[model samples]
Target chain A: MRMPSPKQTLAKAEMDMTPMIDMTFQLIAFFMVLLNFAETEQDARIKLPSSELAKPPEVALESPLVLQLTKDDKVIFGGELLPISGLGQPLSREKRFLELNGVDPKEATIVIRADGDAKTGVVQEVMQLCQENDFEIFALRAKQELAEEEP
Target chain B: MKLRNTGELSDKVDIQMTPMIDIVFLLLIFFIFNFRIVVQEGDFNIRMPVAGPSAASIDTQLPIRVRLTSDDEGNLTGIVAGDRKLDNFSDLHQFILAQVGNDAGPDGADNMEVELDCDYGLKYRYVISAVTAISGYVTADGHIVKLIQKIKLSPPKKPS
Candidate 1:
C-alpha cells in the first residue's frame, strides 16, 4: 500500500487592510482641512505685541504690502533685509511696480509687523518713509490676545 | 447523466497594495512636513498722508494728543494723554472711553482722532498697547466697541 500522504495543513494569513486604509484616509482628510494656504508672510525674529482689540478684518485688505521690522531696527521687505534709511530704494521700486499694474501707491495697504522690543522711533520712521513714498494706508499688525472669562 | 468533476475553488484577484501604500505614506510625510502652527494676527490701521499743514487744519476737532515716554532701555516710564498724566494703559483706555462715548454714527464722537507722540527710546509694544487702548475695547458680549477710529503718529523726536 502507498505510504499515507502527509497531512497538508497550510493556512493563508491575509491581514484585513480595510480599517487601516479607512484610518489613513481619515487622517489625510483631517490634515487637508487644517492646511492653510494663505501665503501669510511671517518672520520668526519679530515678536508681535498682543492686543485684545486686534480683531482680524471682516474683509481682506486690498493690495496689502507687508513690512517686517526686526528688533535691531532693520526692515525686511520682499525677503531682503535693509536698514530704515536703506528702505527708500525698495519702497520706490514697490511703488513703481504698483503703478505699472495700475494700482495707486496710496490704495495699497502697508502692513507693518514690528518686533515688540523694537524702538518706537524706528517704527515711526518706517511709517514716515512709507508716507514719503506715497503709500499712505498703514496697518500696524498685532497678535490677538484672548481675554479671561468672567465668572 | 454522467459528469466529469474538476476540483477547483473560486477565482480570486489579488490587488498589489505595495505601490499604493508607498504613495500614501509619501503623501502623509509631505503634509506632515508642510504643517505649521501660525499665530493669529490683526491690524490697527493708521491712515497718515504726508503731514501737511492743510490736513491738520482740515479737522475741526483737535486730535487727542497721547505722549508715551520711555527710559534708555526702552521700558515705558510714563504715559500722558493730553494734559492728564496716566499711570498705565488702563487709565489711558478709561480716559479715551470717557472722551468718546460708545456711539457709532456719522456724528458720533468715534470720529475723534488720536495722535500718538512716542519718545525715541520707547518700546514698540507700549505704542501698540496705547493704540489698542485708544482704538476700541471688547465688551462682555464679545462685541468690539470702537472708540476712536482715527490714529496718527507724530514725527519721530530726536533720539535721547
Candidate 2:
C-alpha cells in the first residue's frame, strides 16, 4: 500500500458550523430589537442639553415618568398636548405606576425631556408638577458628551 | 508498485469557512459596540429639590432659585439669582459659595439644592451653562467639586 502525505491526511471532509452561526444570528437579532430606533418618547423637536459632569445612574430607573416639551412651549404627555396649567393630571397617572410596583411615589424618578430652545419657565413648571405629585427624583435628559451633539 | 488514484477523493470539494466566521464575528462586535453609542442619546440623570409646593415648612432653607432670562431675539441676557442680577456664571458660583460657604463637606445648605428656572424660547445652550455653573465644573487638578449636589427645575412662569 502507498502512504498518503501529511497534507492529504490533515484535510478534513467536513466541519459543523451550525451552532456558531446560530448563536451569532441570535445575537444580531437581539441587538436589532434592543435598538428601538423609532419607538422612543424623545421627540425630534426637543433638543436636549449636554453635560460633561452628567453621570449615569448608579441604580437603574425602572419605568420612569417621561415629560416631553417642545420649543414652542407645548408640553405633551400620553400623546395629548397638555396645557401648562394642567401638568398635574399626567403625574396623577404616573404615580400609579410606582404604586403598582409597591414603591413610594416620592422615591420614583421623573425624566424631563425638554427642547433646547424650550422656555426655562415651561421646564420648571413641569418639575414643579412632579414635585407636587411627591416624585422626589428628577432626571433632566441631556447629552452626556459633546460627541452626542450631532443632530 | 503502482498506486491507483481514488476518483471520489479527487472529485470531493470542501468550502473553507474560517474567513467567513471571522468576518461575521467582526460584524457582531461592531454592532455590540454601536449599541452603547445609540442608547446614550435618550436618557440622562439629575436630582430633584425636595422643597415642593406642599413641603415649604419641611425644609427651612429653599434652594437658591436661579432664573435664566433672555432677550427678545432669544439671546441669554441675564442670570437672575434671587433679587440680585449676576453678571455671569462666575458670579453665580461666587454667590453660591458665599451663601452655602465652602465647608468641603456635608455641612452647607443641608442638601445643597439649586432650582434652575429656564425660559421656553431660549436655546438649551444657556440652560446648559446654568446647569454647569450650579453643578460645579472641573478644577485645574481634574477634581469635580459641586456647589450643590441636589438640583430642581422651577415651575414655568405663566404667560402674562
Docking class of 1: medium
- lDDT, candidate 2, A1-151, per-residue tens: 9998897679656667899899998998888677665445666666677666555556667567778888877887877777777777777877886688798887677877787777766676677777778776777777665323324
- Model 1, span A1-151: residue lDDT tens: 8765554455577998889888887887777777787745888888999999888888899799999999999999999899888999899999999999999998899999999999989988998899889998999999999976778
True contacts kept of 2: 0.60
The digit string of per-residue lDDT tens for model 2 on B91-150 reads 987887787775444656555567777665556667766777776656555556766656
Every prediction: chain A TM-score: 0.91, 0.65
Candidate 1 wrongly placed segments (more than 4 Å): A1-7, B1-10, B53-57, B102-106
CA-based DockQ, model 1: 0.79
Worst 10 residues of 2 chain A by lDDT: A142-151
TM-score of 1: 0.91
DockQ for each of the predicted structures, in order? 0.79, 0.34
Every candidate's CA RMSD: 3.0, 7.8
